[model samples]
Target: MVERVVATEEAIQLINKLKSIHGPLMFHQSGGCCDGSSPMCYQEGELKVGASDVLLGHIGGSPFYIAADQYAYWKHTQLIIDVVNGRGGMFSLEGPEGKRFLTRSRVFTEEERKELQL
Candidate 1:
């Protein structure tokens, strides 16, 4: 099965580190502006997921969601969560570590899109 969201090894390492300190975690892709454009990590229930949020999949056992409206613009692509050396969203967990979670994407191939029923 194809996953809509996946993380690189480095990202998985960071997630593990954060999880060790924060316990269970979850990720939300921001819509835009301020703390909305990047992927924000939270302590499970810290951020609420409403009917408008779509669960893309899990990365490092953490649920990853995208706003319904945001998913509309990104539906054709697959989300790749990565880690980089920099501050992430002001409110995201990784900000204090001097490293931020970054999101990269790739357009699904015709086969993948079909398999995903996209």
Candidate 2:
């Protein structure tokens, strides 16, 4: 099962907003540039949680779901999804702060930021 690190209030708010539009909030941690992980928001039908899937605690009372395939990578990972207020709905991730992994993906995009209302 995947564990949940302490999430910030901004992170919880973003999750709540995503959950309102979608059914639940789903993200995954996989091999990336650095020895760290990157969180990617998935659409409702994009996630495939199974019996072996881990049910991590909620963020701001919103259920955070992680797929079974991503459990191993997230075991010791610290994921913090925070919103950059007054920044055009931009969000930030703070954990290991590994520059390699953060740069691997365009984690934050103008369109995505606006969509999530970050």
Candidate 3:
């Protein structure tokens, strides 16, 4: 099975660091203005996920999700979660860590699309 989302080693390290301090974590992708679209990390259950949200996959042992509508726009690509210097979203847990979680994507190949049944 192919994963729709994955994290870089650096990002995973940071996630582990955050987890050590905050316990289990979760991620959510949104289309809100500003940096809201950046993957937002939160302690699991910190933010409520409802019927409008869809589970994309997991990264660093945490679940990653996106708004159902947002998923529609990103479904054809694989989301690469990485960490970069700077503040993350105003509401994201990483904002205070001096590193932001960035989301990069690559278009799925024909084979991968077929494997994933896209």
Candidate 4:
């Protein structure tokens, strides 16, 4: 069985706020800068899950989904997403043994940060 890391309380609140306007929250990770880690939120139906998909449970009542392949890689990963205050939003992942990586974006503008608040 695949293990799932629960979304933090802050993440849950942020996702709920986004769902109020955008509907279900969609999550995806991909190979990119900062040790091959990336995560983004989109409007409902923006993401398509394949047969091998893994349901990661809901974050603040919003369905949180992820790809099976990606889950395999993130099995023991920890993610921290922040949007509160004016510090912009960022996504970071740390492996089981403390290895960590941040999103590729050097800095997020006000609008961009708000858009990806969750």
Summarize candidate 2's per-residue lDDT along 1-118 as a digit string, tens digits. 3324445555666666666766655554433433323454555447565676565555555445555566455544444544443322012222212211121212434554455444
Q: Root-mean-square deviation of each candidate, in angstroms?
A: 0.7, 13.6, 0.8, 13.9
lDDT of 1: 0.93
TM-score of 1: 0.97
Clashes of each: 1, 0, 0, 0
Better lDDT candidate (1, 2): 1
User: Can you give the lDDT of residue 76 in candidate 2?
Assistant: 45
Off by over 4 Å in 3: none
Report every candidate's CA lDDT.
0.93, 0.45, 0.93, 0.47
- Candidate 4 lDDT over residue span 4-94, tens digit each: 3345555666666666766766665544444234454555567676777666654455444556777565544434443333222143211
Q: What TM-score do all the candidates reach, one by one? A: 0.97, 0.42, 0.97, 0.50
Query: Relative to the unseen true structure, what is the Cα RMSD of model 4?
Result: 13.9
The Cα error of candidate 1 at residue 19, in Å, is 0.5
Q: How displaced is residue 118 in candidate 4, in Å?
A: 29
Per-residue lDDT of candidate 1, residues 34-101 (tens digit)? 78888999999999899999999999999999999999999999999999998889889999999998
User: For candidate 3, which ten residues in a row score worst on lDDT?
Assistant: 29-38
Alpha carbon lDDT of residue 17, candidate 1? 98
Per-residue lDDT value at 105 in model 2: 17
Error of 2 at 72 (Å): 5.8
Candidate closest to the true structure, highest TM-score: 1
Better model by lDDT: candidate 3 vs candidate 4: 3
What would the per-residue lDDT of candidate 3 be over residues 1-118, giving only the tens digit for each residue? 7789999999999999999999999999987778777999999999999999999999999999999888999999999999999988988889899999999999999999999999
Check candidate 1 and list the clashing pairs: 30-36
Task: Judge candidate 4 at residue 103 and give its lDDT.
Answer: 27
TM-score of 4: 0.50
